[model samples]
Target chain A: MTRFVVSVHIVPRQGLLDPQGKAVADSLRTLGFAGVRDVHVGRHVVLELDAADAASAERAVREMCSHLLANPVTEDFELAGVRPA
Target chain B: MKVGVVSFPGSNCDEDALLAIVERLHESAVLLWHKDHDLQGADVVILPGGFSYGDYLRSGAIARFSPIMQEVVAHARRGGPVIGFCNGFQIACEAGLLPGALLRNVSLQFRSMPVTLRVETSQTVFTNAATAGARLTMPIAHGDGRFTADADTLTRLESEGQVVFRYVNAAGEPTEAANPNGSMRNIAGVCNPGGTVVGMMPHPERALEPLLGSTDGLVLFESLLASVKA
Candidate 1:
């Protein structure tokens, strides 16, 4: 079995309001970090599993995102990348 | 009629909801664990408030996958009544049984107080007891109760009369000062397109008894009973 390391990034949908992200952005400005605009908060999930192949692995991770990892109503998820570890 | 209250590991309001259903509503209520897949033949399903799954990774993000949610979603799809309060509201939205999402309070504080809610419409199973424009008092307790949705979805919900409740003043006017969570359009509660599923951030179950200083929350349960009988 090939062990694959999958990366999932979940972000609040663009149109939805993000209070936490706004807080962070404001805090960054106070710390002298300039040019930070429109900051958004999101979750990064990593999964290690065995799959038949890369195609199967991608499919499995995609299911996980829709079914559990990410909420479609408020959040959007991306299969950032997958690699063999 | 039987009411099913689904309890997750961190659901602290399950017992309160049970008491409200059995003692005040005088209806048979069952406790369905999150791990269990069966709904126990409940005529109505309620996802009571509380920090389910410790509010980890996001409120209701993890608990939405609980086995019983599958049945709850199916129940709503079949035109059965389903009500979600607070954290339960978050789960319902996460499960796609309802539209929009509960965002963090703009103030970033855990707000716990009674607020006036205007009945936007009594056309659904959950709000049938109130007159269309009547105002009711209910308590809201949460740090992430701001309702947000895309412009198209928001317009659709408004045009479809799916917005069941809105934060309002004692005079029954939706005012910016009365909105505690900065929710879009001062929205306090909403229902699915089919009108069978509901999700609200306020804790109506917490305000049902007079000893708790108010009885305005009872109307929702009463409406449910009335709808079930009809």
Candidate 2:
């Protein structure tokens, strides 16, 4: 078994209202960053676990994202990276 | 009838729910801890309001994995009466005991005020005693109480009478101005297809007395009592 560190990024699903992101974008526009199109606030989670290999570790984290890390109904998750810990 | 109010790590309204049943409805009630697996033979279960798990990872997301939730899920699957209020409603959605999801309030504000709700249906166990068109006032305190679902689900809920309550104006009409947190279609409460499980963002237990502003919440407790007895 190898210890692997996985990073996952979860974001609000498209077409759903992201209030915090909107607030941030509004603030950015007020700050003179007129080029801002939009922003969607979400979350990033990092986990360290022992798995047989990198593929298994990524697969396991994907399962975690579907089951608990990210809400399937409202959020989408993707693995940002995986590395030996 | 015995009512069980689950007390999660940060739940603040479990006692209010218990008292609503015992003091107002004259029914027996108990507090079930999040770590315990037993329901104590409770006939009805209430997932009360408050910031369970400190609203981590989207409100009730984390609390849904508590040890007691497994038993609660089983109890719900057995056709037991279950109701979730505010944070409890979020938890119910996370647990899949109810459909849809609660997103961050569109106003980006933690709304803590009383709002008017039009009882859309009295067919569910939670609102059986309420008139179909009755207006009730209750308090809602949450930052993530905006209910959202797919377009198809919304259409089905509307057609099948799953939408039990809606935010309404003083004149009892659902309007954009009446929606407290930008919930879709101004929905304030909903029930499962079977009408046995219900979830709402309003804190009915907090409005059980006139001194607290309204006693309209008592009708919900009365409805439950009547349903269980029947």
Candidate 3:
């Protein structure tokens, strides 16, 4: 089995309501962080796994996103993984 | 024999849930509006999805104080099996019937997608029909599905095996990329001390038929029915 490094973000999918993100953007501006015009929040996750190959691991990771991790309708996942160092 | 789908003012999934429970499964169900009390003799109370009160003032924050929720809490306290989905999960947390709060999505966006759930424990009525490590594919639609709790509570919940399901990847694998809402430790659903009441952000009732593309969720409803008969 090959070990790989998995890094990804889990965010709300487009078209669903995001009242919380809007509130935070306003708060950042209120706090005098003016340079930021648009802000969206999502989780950044890093994982290490042992698999036969990167494709297999990616497939596994993608499955997790579709079935469990990311909600398909409203959320999108950006992921990249490589063989462990 | 009767399934109760609780309906808050803005809840849109009541009828859909009822159809899944009755038409697909051939079981009897009732739509209990938020104002009505008594649960209408429902054996299992299911809190369906929707943006209650328009998701205003935080997801499910206001609905926690609804009249029926009080009774729901009382009923759950007495060891009745209650299932909460999506906003219902948020309301359950708000009412202190379950642990953790459903915060805004990590990306601060609304999420509507199919999620794979890994069954962490199958001791409860809802999950008993499946094996402990069973994987279920279901749809989860919510914004504040990020689950957060105090460190102590988190430890206890983990130690007691209260975690029911976790979001995973498309191939039915458990990994970080699939965790849609940034739930703590990838926690998607949990139960109370009694284990009878379970709250989950994923909509199991939403996937009771192949027309929706999966029947993995039907096991939960069947388990509840079995308990009702027991």
Judged by lDDT, which candidate is best? Answer: 2
Across A11-72, the per-residue lDDT of candidate 3 in tens digits comes to: 76554445566778889999999987666667676778888888888888888666545544
Docking level of model 1: medium
Q: Which candidate comes out best when scored by TM-score?
A: 2
Which residues of candidate 3, in runs, are more than 4 Å off?
Answer: A1-85, B170-173
- Writing each residue's lDDT as its tens digit, candidate 2 over A1-85 gives 9999999999999999888999999999999999999998889999999999999999999999989999988899989999999
Model 2 clash pairs are: none
TM-score of each: 0.93, 0.99, 0.73
- Tens-digit lDDT track for model 1 on B148-171? 888899999999999999999888
Q: In model 3 chain B, which range of ten residues has the least summed lDDT? A: B167-176
DockQ versus reference, model 3? 0.06
After TM-score superposition, what is the CA distance of residue B30 in candidate 3 from its true location, in Å? Answer: 0.9
For model 1, the stretches where C-alpha displacement exceeds 4 angstroms are: none
Q: How many residue pairs clash in each candidate?
A: 0, 0, 34
Clashing pairs in 1: none
Candidate chain B TM-scores, in order: 0.98, 0.99, 0.95
Q: Rate the local accuracy (lDDT) of all candidates.
A: 0.90, 0.94, 0.81
Q: Which of candidates 1 and 3 reaches a greater TM-score?
A: 1
**Candidate 2: global Cα-lDDT?**
0.94
Q: Candidate 2 regions off by >4 Å?
A: none
